[model samples]
Target: MDLSALFSLMGKVALITGASKGIGLSIAEIFAAAGAKVVISSRKQDALDEMAGQLRARGYEVTGIACNVGNMADLEDLVKKTVDLYGTIDILVNNAASNPVFGPVHDTSLEAYDKIMEVNVKAPFHLMKLCFPYLRESSNASVINISSIGGISPEPGLGIYSVSKAALISMTKVFAKEWGDHKIRVNAICPGLIKTKFSEALWSNDKIMAHMMKALAIKRVGTSEEIGAAALYLASPASSYTTGTVLTADGGFTI
Candidate 1:
């Protein structure tokens, strides 16, 4: 088999959320590097616009849009803009998520709990539904849901946040089965502790970092680029036969 064919993402158009920085931004950059036109969306227009400029300057096709995933109308606008600019969205990366509250589940307020579920689970669901038409229109459409390793193995202080990720795992399966008929592959990537702003509280603490490192097979935290490469494989024709699967890029943290 030609391995190069498996890694190429050329000619594809990808729409990624929470793409201003961290894993989302890394995924968008990698996709653009692979010759895919990428549209990045986030809550902050300034950040998105800045990143878009950097990518565009590098000769990659990229654009930025402001979108708050929890808002359905904003999500619809995001999709509409993508279609207007790119014609169709061949790849959809549901990377936008939030964990506003941490600590015990019982101590967490209803408002915080609801917000976590809304951003992590509901937003992705809505995006998929809204993008279904464009996705089905593609000859080789792919949907990537960003989940957490905590979903499979709950953490001590991450109660509601972990629960939401668990829902995402289940959601991935449901969508993959439902969308398979359209030949739109759906998959999830469960990233371990990465050195990103989203996970700074965990990885930045010396004590917590030490404990996490002990459990990791690689003896280190994973990087955003690592997850980006995995996403590229799934989005590309490399894994055409793959669907309804979760690729754990946790550096053996689960093991």
Candidate 2:
């Protein structure tokens, strides 16, 4: 088998949300390196522009579009601007997420719960719908949702976030089944204890780190780059036959 050819994303256009840092940025970097025209999105324009400029300097076709996924208008503009630039979207990655409250599920406020769902679940749902037309037109369309292991097994202090992620997982399956006819593949990735700012609360704590290390088969925290590679596989032709799948890159923490 031609490995390079299998994983190649040449001539593809990918729109990735929350891509200014961490897992999202890693995925954008990998995709661009694989020859995809990448559009990275986040809330801050400066951050997105800086990252996009850096990638472009590396000889990749990259653009930055700032968007707050929680806002429907922002999402609409995101899709519009992306399509206006690239003409089509071959891969869509819903990586932007929020978990404002870090306490018991019962302790979370209604406002926090709404924010969590809006960003983590609703944003992805709406973005997919907006991109459906372009995605369906692509010869190899793929959607990769950045879910979490918490969605599979809820962790303490991240209750509402876990619920949102679980909802995302279900949404991935739903889209996969519904869009299969159009040859659009939808899949979810469940990363565990990644060393990202979003997960700093867990990985930065000595007590939590010690407990996590004991459970992880890899014996250490996972990296954003590792999750990026997993996403590359799902986005590339290598995973053409894969859809409605939950790919776990948790370093065996679930074991």
Candidate 3:
């Protein structure tokens, strides 16, 4: 097998959600640089526009669409727009997620719990459903779900979010089995604590940082580029045989 073919994502179209900043945006950037026409979505159109413009300036084919993953109609519109722009969706990175509440499980309100599940798990599942047909047509179709190490092991003050991530991991397995016949490889990326704005609540806290310093083998938080690199591997041919797998990119936080 040619080694270069393993990492190539040329001639593919990828859609990423929660792509205005942090890991989602990084995935969009890396996917575009890998030669895939990328569609980025998030709640804010202005942020998406900026990201898309930056990627396009770098000579990659990229478009931005605003989407609130919690809304099914928005999801439908996102799919329609993606297909309209690129004709088909070859790759999908469900990187959009939420954790609106932070406290004990007992203190969590019903609304917060529902919101967490809606964005973190349900949205990914439904978006994949919407893209199933287009994904099936591609010989190199892949679905990369962004889960978290918090899902693998319970984290302090993050109850519902962890549960949702765990469900996402399960969803990844189920879809991998169901879609395997169509040659669509479904996988989950469980990132360890990355140093992104989305994770400021953890890293910005002095106590949490000290705790992580001792628990993590890598002795530092992960980077958005690190997650982006992992997404590229799973999105490209490098991971052709990898499916129904949770590729954890946390700085060895589990260990």
Candidate 4:
């Protein structure tokens, strides 16, 4: 295989949710740079507009669509809009997630658990179903779910979120197996302790950061860009024949 061709995302139309900032935005940026026409979404239109404008100025093909993934109507509209503008959805990145509860599983309220499951687990499932037609049309279809290391191993004060993520991993496998015949590759990316606003609780604390330094083989935290690169690999032809796999980019933290 030609080295450039293996990783090129040219002509692909990618829809990435929770893409205004953090891991989602990083993946969208990288996808656009790799030649994919990317449609990015977040709960806020202004933020999405800003991100899209910045990426376009860099000579990348991008569009901003504000959609709260928690709502099925929003998800349906997100897929419809993508297809309307791009003709098809070649890639779907279910990166939008919620972690509302920060207590023991036993102490978590029903409301908190519902919100966590709604955004982190249920949203992705519905989004995939909504985009199934468009994804089926693309010969190079791919779905990248942004799971977490917490899913693989429980995290203190993040019990509910971890459970949702664990469900997402299972969902990835289920879809990958079922969609294999359709040639729609599905996978999950488990990022570990990335230094983003979403993970500030862990990286921002001096004591927590100190402990993480000694725990990780790299002696440092990971970045959203690192996870984005991993997404690119799974999204591109370079990862052809790879599906139903959980690619953990955790700075050897799991080891």
Among these predictions, the greatest TM-score belongs to 2
lDDT of 2 by residue, 66-132 (tens): 9999999999999999989989999999999998998788999999999999999999999999999
Distance from true position, residue 103, model 3, in Å?
A: 1.2
Output the lDDT of residue 167, model 2. Answer: 94
lDDT of 4 by residue, 71-150 (tens): 89999888888889989999999999988767678999999999999999999999999889889889799999999988
Instruction: Give candidate 2's total backbone clashes.
Output: 0
User: Which lDDT tens digits does candidate 1 get at residues 174-236?
Assistant: 999999999999999999998899998798789888888888899888899999999999999
Stretches of model 3 off by over 4 angstroms after superposition: none
Candidate 4's error at 44, in angstroms? 0.4
Off by over 4 Å in 1: none
TM-score of each: 0.98, 0.99, 0.98, 0.98
**Candidate 2 TM-score, C-alpha based:** 0.99
User: Whole-model Cα lDDT per candidate?
Assistant: 0.93, 0.96, 0.92, 0.93
lDDT of 3 by residue, 1-255 (tens): 786678888999999999989999889888888889999999999988888888898899999999999999999999999999889999999999999988899999999999999999999989999999999999899999999998899899999999999999999999999999999999999998898988999999999899999988899989999999999999888888989999999888887
Instruction: Return the TM-score for candidate 3, rounded to 2 decimals.
Output: 0.98
What C-alpha lDDT does candidate 1 achieve relative to the native structure? 0.93
Model 4, residue 201: C-alpha shift (Å): 1.0
